[model samples]
Target: MTAAATTHQHTNCLRCGRKLTSTKSTATGYGPTCTRKVKAAAKAEIVATYKPHLVAKAEELIEQGGIVALRGRNVFQVVASNGVDTYKAARQGCTCAAGLKGKHVCYHRIAAHILSLAA
Candidate 1:
């Protein structure tokens, strides 16, 4: 299904217990009505942790590697020396247990995504 369709079917904000519509509607991972609350929380957390350089790198990696193909197997068919490979989210989330527990992006995957974007 399309991302919009999938997001529409989503029941709850992944970041909060509020209800949600589509991922596009709730792009920040919060329900439409409570988006601000989620953003505040996220902002506070980001400020409390991680450096600016690390955050930049993670963003870069995501830009390059976030969108994986439907190949159904390899993270990337061909890996460049400067590129780092990562697994597609089996269920639209980080594979790391910690990430799942905290309901946040995993550091490893974030790092990879940031690096990819930088490249």
Candidate 2:
């Protein structure tokens, strides 16, 4: 597999809010230093916060395109893995059984968190 970029365009860096005066910076919406920092932070944030299996499940939920935004407050409707049920998920909680347990971290919550970041 491969990925490629042929152009870049942004007026400001997304991370530090700096004016992007150079072409490369504008293209990435990040200055060189911030670009590296953002990548590292993104990779670290998820892994450090959740179990690896849960993270994989959350990513699977996203890849299945079963997430829907609602009410514009970092809330979402996430489909269950069984594909027969849906749950409302927020940053702090979810409606899934595991979420109801209060001691478990549900993938639905992780999916909502991931969606919030992309937003």
Candidate 3:
């Protein structure tokens, strides 16, 4: 993807208050480049922390003959089944870099996360 020649204007780094205007490489619409990495890492950490809990719950629900169907933006489908129980999810949009990569959060991930929590 081609970045605009002029960087999007911002007052200050939302996270660390570092000035991003002076930086050559930056994640648009956000604070400094460093803060972007920090934010992404923090988000990933939180998601990773929650993953085990979510997976365990989902597995338990599946084992108990419960089925769940979730829909999101990307239209991607995921099915999880254990003999009698099955859970399915279909998302409607793409979250990868080709789509809304900078957005970080994708509909497919959100839907699956929601289902995992629901489980």
lDDT of each: 0.40, 0.68, 0.37
The true-versus-predicted C-alpha distance at residue 30 of model 2, in Å, is: 22
Model 1 global lDDT (CA atoms, 0 to 1)? 0.40
**Can you give the TM-score per candidate against the true fold?**
0.32, 0.63, 0.24
Q: What's the lDDT for residue 105 in model 1?
A: 55
- Kindly list the per-residue Cα lDDT of model 1 for residues 1-119, writing each as its tens digit: 24542333335543334566565544443455444542343345543566665455443332223333233322322222234443443223454464467555554444433223222
Model 2 spans with C-alpha error above 4 angstroms: 1-42
Residue 20 of model 3 has an lDDT of 57
Clashing pairs for model 2 are 8-27
**Between 1 and 3, whose lDDT is larger?**
1
* Off by more than 4 A, model 3: 1-8, 23-33, 36-40, 51-119
Per-candidate clashes come to 14, 1, 8
Q: For candidate 1, which ten residues in a row score worst on lDDT?
A: 72-81
Q: Write one digit per residue (lDDT tens) for candidate 3, span 27-94.
A: 33234444345334434543564455544543343222232233332232332332322223332233
- The candidate with the higher TM-score, 1 or 3, is 1
